[model samples]
Target: MKVIDLRSDTVTTPTEAMRKAMYDAEVGDDNAHEDPTVNHLEDLVCALLGKEAAILTASGTMSNLVAALAHTNRGDEVIMGSKAHMFWNEAGGVSTLGGVQVQLVPNDKGGRIDPADVEAAIRPDDVHAPRTSLVCLENTHNQCNGSVLTNEDMKAVADVAHAHGLPVHVDGARIFNAAVALEMPAHELCKDVDDVGFCLSKGLSAPVGSMLCGSADFIEEARRWRKIVGGSMRQAGVIAAAGVVAVETMIDRMVEDHAHARRLAEGLSHIPGINVDPDDFQTNIVFVGVDPNTGSTEEFTDRMKEEGVLTAYRGGGRFRLVTHREVGAEDIDTAVDRIAKVASEMRNAR
Candidate 1:
């Protein structure tokens, strides 16, 4: 049996081109700003995101942590959507390591925090209130079925943050996905934000690393925080070379992933015991809801695994399936058939 892993885009392996590039990459001490390939990767990200400078980090979590450390002081608060990846998925590193408080504003189904909500969440300049120093957002928000936030959506929140003298940071782990979905440039999507961090390892299919881009001064500060967080690397060009290829070659191809996700969502919707809205299939992530009458999400996932179809059971009667370079249209059909069989068996058993 073939295993169709729909767990996450992070499961993707490096391409042959990426491997070859890694083998041929020039290397030096990246900690001293001397790794030519790492420097080139950073330059590529800066150009793509329209930032003055950028830094490479070990992971998206590290990029967010470094951004938090660089943008806020201890005891300061950062505002973000209730569903922001930093708040839910990053293991509370910002608060634990940086002493920064995370203030949550309600996120709509579309993964947007209302600009008015952001305005209301800002703290007054008072002795008792924790200073609101930063605003954070996620593009193609992971928790919201990979919903893509538009350029205008970003600008509205950024305008409010800037008005309050706060810097804005976007956890753009899948910004290129958002860009492809919107038929816009990634840099344009991030034009109004102060800082943005994007992953090379996710849908981009690089084997490792994420990039944090901003002004040169901010990047200098972030570099210090990167070292503090133990993210400083030496001779990292070997991996960074793949990142260069991911940027240059992998971005435009993401439309295929989006199509596969839509197809998967539509297919799953036909299953009697599965619930999904194909219209909400915006990017590469599809969130499927299991009917309680059929079984719990845990049981559904276990059955799917038994059927050679792997998915992520995101508690609360939901499962998240992500499409990447490895999943094909045929694989989508196979997964749906497997899932349908599982759902039918579970429903009939009930």
Candidate 2:
């Protein structure tokens, strides 16, 4: 049987075009800003994100870390959703390297952080308080079932942050997915924020890399942070060349992935032991709640793996399945069938 991997979009491999671009790319020392291909990729990303400048990083985690380190001072605090990738998935790099504290606002099931809650979370100007230097938003929030934040929602958060003279950074790792879902331009999704970081690896099908885009001065500072974090690369155009193709070709195809996710969610919902809200399905991520009577999350996932389908079990009974460039509609159907069979077996076994 063919294996279907629904684990994450990050598992996507580069395309044939990307491979050719990588092999033919021009190169120079990127640390000196002399790599022509890398420079083009940066310029292209800046144009796409509507920022004055952009810097390429080795990974999305590095992009967020560099942006965080650049936006805030040591001992300052950054406000974001409690379920944010920065707060949960990333290895606490901001607090570890940037010496900043995190203040979290509650995130709704749809991944929206209430602007009022954000305002309340900002610290007052006092001697004893840690200054609230930044506010962060995640568009196409990963942990929140791949919820897409609207431009108005982002602007509302930015309005509150700006009133207090705090900059906003968007952890836009899956931003293109948001843009495609909302039928808006990618840059519009991030226009309200001071800085934005997006992944070229996920959904876009690039082998590796992310971009941090912002004002020229902010990026210059972020470049320093990148160097400090040991992210600066010489002749990085080898990978950046593939990134160029991703930006040019991969974005428009995300709608297919979104549709596949919806189909998967719909199929899983029909199965007896799986609980999923197809209406909550928006982007490429699907969250399914497994019945405790059926099995533990780990047990369900392992059984699915045995059936030649892979998935991730988030804490609690929630299992996450993500659709990407590689997985097609047929694959989603196969995964749903395999998962349902496994869940049914567990229920029968009990």
Candidate 3:
């Protein structure tokens, strides 16, 4: 039986071109700002995001952590949506390592935080209140069925953050996905933000790394935080070379992933016990809801695994399925058929 893994885009491997680039890459000490390939990757990210500079980190979590460290002081607070990857998925590294507090504003179904909510969440300049130093947003929000926040949605929250003298940082791990969905340049999506970090590994299909982009001064500060977090690398050009290829070659192909996800959502919606709104998903991630009368999400996912399909069982009767380069349209159909079988079996057993 063929295994259709819809767990996440992070499972994607580097392409043959990426491997060749890695083999031929020039290497230097990246810690000393001397790795030519890493420097080139950072330059490419800066150009793509319209930022003045960028720093490469080991992962998206590290990029977000470094951004938090660089942008806020100890005891300062950062505001983000309740459904943010920073809030839910990052293991509380910002609070634990950066000595920062996270203030959560409710995210709507589409993964947008109301600008008024952000304005209200800002702390007054008082001795007792934790100073709100930064505001964070996610593009193609992971937990919200990969909902893509528009440029206008971003600017609305950013305007409020700036009014309160706070910097806006975006955990743009899938910004390119959002860009492709909106038919806009990634830089245009990021134009109003103070800083943004995007992943080379997820959807981009690089073997490793994420790039944090901002003003020259901010990125210089981020370098120190990266070192403090033990993310400094030496002779990293070998992997960074793959990142260069990921940027140059892999972005446009993401539209195919998006189409596959939509197909998955539409197919699964036809199943007897599955609930999914095809219109709710805008990128590669699809959220599948299992009817309680049929089975719990755990049971549904377990049955899916038994049928040779892997999915993430999010709590509260939901599963997350992500499509990537490795998952083709045929694979989407296969997964939906497998999932439908499971759902039907569960319903019959009930």
Model 3's lDDT to the true fold?
0.94
Q: Per-residue lDDT for 87 in model 2? A: 95
Q: Write down the lDDT of every candidate, Cα atoms only.
A: 0.95, 0.93, 0.94
User: What lDDT tens digits, residue by residue, belong to model 2 across residues 1-350?
Assistant: 99999899999999999999999999999999899999999999998999999999999999999999998899999999989999988899999999999999999988999999999999999999999999999989998899999999899999999998999999999999999999999788788889989999999999999999999999999999899999999999998999999999999999999999999989998999879989998999999998998988888888889999988746688989999999988898888889889988999999
Weakest 10 consecutive residues of candidate 1 by summed lDDT: 308-317
Q: Write candidate 3's Cα lDDT for 122-226 as tens digits.
A: 999899999999999999899888999999999999999998788999999999999999989999989999999999999999999999999999999999999
Model 2 per-residue lDDT at 186 = 77
Candidate 1 to truth, TM? 0.99
- TM per candidate comes to 0.99, 0.99, 0.99
Per-residue CA lDDT of candidate 1, range 1-350, in tens? 99999999999999999999999999999999999999999988899999999999999999999999999999999999999889988899999999989999999999999999999999998999999999999998999889999999999999999988899999999999999999999888899999999999999999999999999999999999999999999999998999999999999999999999999999998899889999987999999999999999999999999999888846998999999999999999999999999999999998
- Residue 338 CA displacement from its true place in model 3, Å: 0.7
Per-prediction backbone clash count: 0, 0, 0
* Residue 240 accuracy (lDDT) in model 2: 95
Error of 3 at 112 (Å): 0.7
**In candidate 2, residue 292 scores what lDDT?**
91
Query: Which parts of model 1 have CA positions greater than 4 angstroms off?
Result: none
